[model samples]
Target: MASMDVSAQVSDEHSAARGHCDVELTHGLIITQDTIRIVDNNQTRVQINQGNQLLVRGQWIELDAKETEILEQYNQMIRDTVPELVELATDGVNISLNAIENVVSGLSDKEPEVLKAQLQYVEQALRNKFKRGDDFFYIAPQSLSKLDDFFAEEVSKKIHTAIQGSLGAMLIALGDALESREGNIEERINDVGTRMEIITAEIDKSLKKKAEQLALKSEEYCNCLNMLDNTESKLQKLVPELADFDLVKIKSDLQYSTH
Candidate 1:
């Protein structure tokens, strides 16, 4: 809202020594050579002994309505320009500190050329970061590193969006693939269950045939009962219900038949 004011200050005692007053806006400190100009929301205070036409020089001391509007427009232009530069740079580029320094140094002397160089530097840096991906995240320090990366990612994403165009089909395809994979897993599980059932039926038939082949003698039947008990114990490890099988009753019946 406040424009910079540059003024010449002179006092009666030290009128020979021409002094200048330039207030630093960035810091809220009042700085003056021999006089001070204080402005508030209400009014402005100008302190100087007005001697008729004593080479008074000031930059309007403040901005008028028109000047303020123009200043705002210029600020907005700067903001817009920087983002555009970042986007352009991030496309595919590289920038060195030296390049940036050179561009900045030339800014005062060659305004147009310096601006172009600055844009190029920004673009190169951004492009490099985008290419680096996760690796580039921690490369920069706190000062300007974070800001540079932020701008680079923003620009890179913008470029990607522009190139890729539509995302609707891609999303739909992803969803369909996920659904298909889930169905395949369910079918495989059902197949496994069917195979397990067939295997269990075959094992049951084999166990019955083995029991019929063994002849019952007194000691042999006792030993056979013991072996079956042991077998059932082992089977319980694989199938929990096998542990509840009538091992004790079967052993008693075999012993009775043998006697």
Candidate 2:
């Protein structure tokens, strides 16, 4: 593999400032200071003055000295479109929750906490989506931090991993809370043991599935590492193969690998 190099050039003639990097992008460009700019495969670019303005642009939107027309258009879209999408998301939960509850009820033996946990999860997830916060995915731009740009090719992938992570975190917390309730159920009726066992079994099954997935990825990652540097990864190798890997994390390995 031929190593890549990157540097910057400025218009100044007398004393030119320069910096070099070995950074690689799957489908994007990163220009370092003297004015850093990154252009994605889709031709969307993020330009920064290293400290001042950051611009993310792709396609024209007429933001110059335009009018109240565009402002009103965006405001209308935010009011109409945002709530419609929110309601749709909530409706989706309602439908899925009904189905899940139906199945849980069959096995629930009228246990209150079981259904409570599921409702709480759905309600809380939806609630978090609407509230303005650091974690909330805000649609309306405001005085909050903005993403200059994200490599477009990874949007679907990023969403998938994000949802998977959110679900995993919710399950871990729900399982813990339910575990406590299981004890109270035990004291009330010995038959409660069966239902708790059922709930625990379900949780364990989900957790196991997640673990298996992680293990598979870990194995693949180890194989990828071995491909990059067999001597370094031999002791750490776990996976026998890999489907594919990307260069996003290569620079992270240098310090530790050198040590």
Candidate 3:
């Protein structure tokens, strides 16, 4: 009779007559919802404690190096699947951001009259459907910035130049009257100075109000640009992780490793 190793003996008499394989794997088998029990060819019985623990109760059936390596490989393969799913989620976020940026840019690049009309529609929808009032003004930084650019380059310059030319003509006339030594020259000089003072004050007040409005508009534009910059920075940091979503490559690697 072959002397069997004492550590490899089975507890039940019905299972003791199995072949001497020294040790057996109790866990790490083909586990699914239906099947729960796993035994290694009856040489030794393995009682699964949980998902990954294998207990032999009274026996110390040890696994060889090959068996241990196989178990490690299976666990590593399972862990590697997680990063692939993360990459897919990141890709979806990137797609959403791209779509939003494209829509905003397209709307802004339109002609001024068309853009103004479109913004009016947007404002109405926000008020009617979304229940957002003049909040559209707060969110329309980019659209408003584009409008300001149009006004500054096309409208404000011509209007300011016309106003300055009119003021210069009035000043020249007043200077001519003061330079003469005619009757009531002193009265005309005082009258011209008073009118000039009034015109200067009005012009100063108008310019100050316009400057304040332009400053506010510029601040809004800068804030929007800053927000976009932050969003871009965050997306760039995640790009490498996003690029790792190669499903074909992951599957190929898993197949090659199994063989």
Best by lDDT: 2
Could you tell me every candidate's TM-score relative to the true structure? 0.15, 0.27, 0.23
Alpha-carbon runs more than 4 Å astray in model 3: 1-182, 231-259
lDDT against the true structure, per candidate, is: 0.31, 0.33, 0.33
Models ranked on TM-score: 2, 3, 1
Ranking of models by lDDT: 2, 3, 1
Local accuracy of candidate 3 as per-residue lDDT tens digits, 1-259: 2346443333232132111111111122222222222223332233323323333433433445644443333333323322222222122322322332343333233223332343344334322211211211111112222333333343334333333444444445545645754566557646645654554455444434444454454343343333333332343243332122111111122211212
* Model 2 agreement with the true structure over 1-259: per-residue lDDT tens digits: 1232222122221111111111222323223323433344435354434223334453222233233233333233223333333333333334444544554444434424534564556446445433233322222211111111111112223323333433444344445556767455334434433454464455444434433443333333332332333321321122112112121223343212312
Clashes of each: 2, 1, 0
Residue 119 lDDT (model 2):
59
* Model 2 stretches astray by more than 4 angstroms: 1-56, 59-100, 107-188, 221-251, 254-259
Q: Which candidate number would show the highest TM-score if scored against the true structure?
A: 2
> What lDDT score is found at residue 179 in candidate 1?
69
User: Over the stretch 1-259, how does candidate 1's per-residue lDDT look in tens digits?
Assistant: 1222222222321222111111111111111232222222323222122211111122232444543343334323323322333333233233322333343333223223333444455455544432233221111111111233343344334323321232223223334444655456446444534543453344334323322221112122333333433443443343343233222223233222312
CA lDDT, candidate 2, residue 228:
36
* Candidate 3 least-lDDT 10 residues: 132-141
Q: On a 0 to 100 scale, what is the lDDT of residue 217 in model 1? A: 20
Instruction: Please list the Cα RMSD from the true structure of every candidate, rounded to 1 decimal place.
Output: 44.0, 19.4, 29.7
